[model samples]
Target: MKFLQWITLTCTVLIVSCTSLFCNMAYVTNEGSNTISVINTATNTVAATIIVGATPIIVAITPDGKTAYVANGGSNTVSVINTATNTVTATIGVGSNPTILAITPDGKTAYVINRNDNSVSAINLATNTVTATIGVGVSPFFLTITPDGKTAYVTNEDSNTVSVINIATNTIITTLAVGTLPRFIAITPNGTTAYVTNENSNTVSVINTATNLVTASIGVGIKPFDIAITPDGKTAYVTNLDSDTVSAINTATNSVSVTIGVSGSRPKLLEITPDGKTVYLAYEDISFVTAINTATNLVTDTIEVGPAPAVLAITPDSKTVYVPNSDNNTVSVIDTATNRVVATIGVGSQPLAITITSNPQPPHSLAGKKKKDIFATQTDRINVITWSAPSEGISPVRYKIYRDAALTNLAGMVSASNALKFEDHNRKNHTVYSYYIVSEDLNGGLSTAASISIS
Candidate 1:
């Protein structure tokens, strides 16, 4: 009998551990209700409704996935929620009418754009207090932080400009003129480029991060309001408010690649799935979340949500979507796999924007991972190569050497901790060979090909 009881206890613990590991959750900000709705991904159900500040317009989650900061437009404050408990722990006062918010990559600070005050308020996440207020243009609407978390690009609606703020100093560094009534801003994953949607001009401005200048302006559709880029950073989707269409842009050429029509009227917010396979858009009047097939750039299905859907967010696993309905003071949860509305969660008044905190932890590489510079010199009968470790924080794993597209185990397994300098002694005179390195993480995740060639 005791053995049976021990066996049962072991099984119960295993079940609980597996459930916790697989159950990802989606979060939505209810602007009208001043609350946030948390939906369980596994069951497509409401896990919790978190009360926040008055009129929460946007919510940003910290990088570590521990806290969520909500911008309350009506209350002129930001609500900090503890993700573990699904409760508001603190409220930081900011400028008036905070419409949107973004957290730095380091998770140390958050930038809130005050639409009425025409300024950006910087909040210290540790203390939950507004530390700096920087003047921006008229009606600052949306803001995006660079991938490196060093700079913030904010769209000023009435001013038709983007205010660039240096995160280190908490000050406005420069303002680049974009288009009329710029409403949204999106930064590339590489932190090298930025895109801004001009609602009045129906165009998207491409800004070069290095120069802080508008490099190109691509005509999109009627009244583009929200923009998002794919995970690969190859394509961008802009929602056309008036035309009920989504404009897809090719990042390489900075041109409109295609235009996808959304059956619902007034598509307001757009979000891409983690795998970059699907896009979820919220339509206000139609009260639905439309799912688009990214491959063909066409609407595949529409999941009926709450009344007057304001914003939407996708879970990190790409299995669930959360939509906030302004009119109903509720949030609708959608199952991505089945393309259906699974649950409706009640929250505080008017939710404007939602962001998720589930950034996947990259795989760790094996030891002795070798790396070589793309540009290396070779002497007579000798090839000299210099290499460095891959980007930090990445997994430290093993390396596989390749020559002329063929795998060569000559270097053996090398540690990723040290930079390697190798000389090819077996090279034939006047022969040309291409060398490459492959890193394998503990989880078997492989690095992209990094290659060098020598003659």
Candidate 2:
């Protein structure tokens, strides 16, 4: 059996939000200021700002969540941010105009897309240096690693192709011709297929990973540029920029199943919560972000944000989402439950990308395997939490829970209780509350922390 290489939580302190657990340190790249804003999600504000290269466009977190690599388009370098200190510890030169980055699952390397040179730079994470530069097609923008970390697929915008790279050898094994102006790419959870969004063609090319071939091209709305796939890999969501809409593609058939309109023009980026319950998209023209319910495929809430909200990234616990406003020089924090702007943080000028990276749990441990289905409902003055039990290891002896980011006080001290649910009395309707759950085994072993936010 393959064992997980668990790293000491000392590498970096970037916030990683997902189903893995919880992280408070997330990083945002500011295009205008040439720096990265370190966001403390617990406070929904910018905690620190670290200077990097010029026009840093994309950031990638190592799988271990200890370090973040920022691609500087103007400086032709990559800045390594150590999460622990929120500082730029190292700078490695790469090809000119690096736009995107993808780290392998093992957290050992990062693949950077250099648009000007039409190549991908493989950086050694431990050494903080570039190991190899593999040539791809024209203007490569985005890349995604497979679940197994064996292969990487990069989207080339100008050549309209997807280059498949063998991670072991750091070489381009093959390139599959895709749609016009392919910009964003996503691989399914099962690692069977990859979906590339074509902006000019307004279509998404579904590629069979085994054969490295484009198996299907599904028509979306006008100018489909970005995409987000569900955790189960059952569906793919594409943001149609020109149409001001989002196309929901059913991955089973590779067809457009639903089209949800945005609040304003230029629906640039979209992301699904870790639970796969809601989809959030940023509207550049209207200065707003819209939240859509996956069940009914209807707009649930519309939040006013800074100018040109370009990217959406959610925390691991599905509690908070950060949207970088390109023109306003700010980042908007959205409370997932309330679907409102809880905080407006002044980042560097023209922040374009937001990335959350955290120290993840072991692959199959009680904490890693205990990804829970957390649900919250607010009725009048009370907020109730309901969740399925942890699936791995022994049943928890009792569930201990806390409210807010800081474990200030016990919500209700019901020790050794078997109740799978709890109700927080007297919670305001619009007040966002963060909860952390600890599952203690019979031998007094406290499992990894599971968290959620209720409003």
Give per-residue CA lDDT, model 2, range 1-455, as digits (tens): 22222212111111222222433577899998898998776666677889999999888876545578898999999998877677888999999898888888778889888889999999988888889999999878888899889999988888888889999999888989888999989889899999999899888998998888888989999999889898878889888888888998999989999998767788877899987999988875778888989878898998888888887889867778898888888888898989988888988889998987543331121111111222354233445555555543334456656653344455753344554666666555455566666654332334355566553
Instruction: Give all candidates' CA lDDT scores.
Output: 0.74, 0.77
Model 1 Cα lDDT, one tens digit per residue, 296-411: 99889988888878667776557677777778777677888899987877655665565655532322222221222222353224454445555533243565555533343344
Q: What is the lDDT of residue 267 in candidate 1?
A: 90
lDDT value, residue 422 of candidate 1: 50
TM-score of each: 0.73, 0.77
Worst lDDT run of 10 residues, candidate 1, spans 10-19
